[model samples]
Target: MIQPHQHADQACSECTQRLGLIESGLRGVTPVRFNAAGWYRGELRREILRLRLNQDVSVLKAITFALQRTLPAKALLVPIPSWKTQKRANPLPALICRSLGRTTKTLLKRCRPTVGQHHLSRRQRLVNMKSAFAIHPDQQSWCVSATPTWIVDDILTSGATAQEALHTLKRAGLEVRGLICLGRTP
Candidate 1:
């Protein structure tokens, strides 16, 4: 079931295991882990693009289902960006947002990166992620009118990351509707 506040108490292992399912090409040499913040971990060096191509579709389909039944149109998809090279290594969130955006007929893009929340406390998670993401400048006009906006990610651990994304988008003047992910820790 979906949680109203988009709590991040769920485990990250569920998404990690699913990412490990495909075994060919980039998946064969990478290591995957359940991050403390409830997100899946993986080497982003070369696998980031491949993961987006392979496993991201299924995850996107799932997000589409969740949003279609809950949110209204004009809900733009904003993915929280990772730190620097991290984007090239494990761009899973971006991948899922792109796919789901097409399926849902919404806009998707990465605005900025916030500090990593892996080992931080709940409060630290919030502080570290504050102002961490923004709607792409090109899409700024789309979000200016208080439309519903959703932050998409792979896992929801601690929720610090999504919370920061929500804050950033909202600060930029978008009505953050909610958070969506592939799995929750429960």
Candidate 2:
């Protein structure tokens, strides 16, 4: 029974710095606070991310509702693809994108599989995500949009995945605004 926070919505500066985005970058609007090493809160975070129950979806929707107001009007939401190549291997990011009520696109795909980032060090995570994403061939023509693009995901940890996503989209000539996620590890 995780409830929404009552404080003003603000981007985590630490997360932005960790993500290595430029100053005043339009990324890192995480409303949910996650403690990866905690027992109770960590379990709650995992359950909501797993999306196995209606309660989990409800919680995510509430989080996204708060996040939506922070985004620029008509910004494009690009979900970071899962390390697994299968179409639905990881659905949380896309689900969050859709929940934001923006123009959601699966424009990126995993170029190659990589190990999970949970147990990896920051440097290890970066190495694992190197060149992991590429523009989806079918979505090539959609890259010419003038709308600001934001990478959407369930959580922001080492930010390796988001960095890779930003690079891939930028290489394809898309204006990647920044990243928006449901939660950030504290």
Candidate 3:
């Protein structure tokens, strides 16, 4: 089963909680090895950010293994799309979902582009992601099934993106269990 990182601090938990992203009563999972500042300076940050630029099989395998242990077996994984409008602009989330050996669905699409959240404050990130995602036109009918779904992402920072994904899916009448990410920023 997935265990919380021993190094996770109260501040990190508080930060996520204060963002009010998990208020839907769904669990949020992340292995917090370091705070956001430290994570940004580390090699894992480079590896994760470069996933869109390069598809590293070894890194993808390692991340998939780590997340798979924690995710519920019955949850259907729905990847949060990147800011780009192109179909597969960023494959990290979907790749991770596929690697997890679970039922994966691409049910959300970016309705509009938004600034990257890496440099934004929590408020800015939330504002930038506002109405950024919508249910894919082709997937509208898929929402009729009340499957336990999870939003998959490379990292969970301010959670603006995940929150918006959750909002979009719920609005479309899907049962979103919560978010599962490779890492969480303190």
- Candidate RMSDs in Å, in order, are 11.3, 7.8, 8.9
Candidate 2 lDDT by residue in tens digits, 1-186: 444435423224443233332333234333212111111235435654556334355445544554676678788989887776565466777777766678888899888989988799999999998999989999999899888888877667777887888888988899987777655665
Lowest lDDT sum, 10 consecutive residues, model 2, at: 31-40
How many residue-pair clashes does candidate 2 contain? 0
Alpha carbon deviation, residue 160, candidate 2 (Å) = 0.6
Query: How far out, in Å, is residue 70 in model 1?
Result: 2.7
- Point to the candidate with the largest TM-score: 2
Give the clashing residue pairs of candidate 1, or none.
Answer: 10-185, 11-185, 37-157, 38-157, 44-89, 44-90, 45-89
Worst 10 residues of 3 by lDDT: 32-41
Q: Please, what are the lDDT tens digits per residue for candidate 1 over residues 96-127?
A: 56655432312333355556566788788777
Task: Evaluate model 2: give its TM-score.
Answer: 0.73
What are the lDDT figures for the candidates, one per model? Answer: 0.49, 0.66, 0.65
**TM value for model 1:** 0.56
Clashes of 1: 7
TM-score to native of every candidate shown:
0.56, 0.73, 0.72
Per-residue lDDT over 7-106 for candidate 3, one digit per residue giving the tens place of the 0 to 100 score: 6311234333333223222233432121121232245555567766777655455444445655678778898888766665677788877767789888
State the local distance difference test value for candidate 2.
0.66
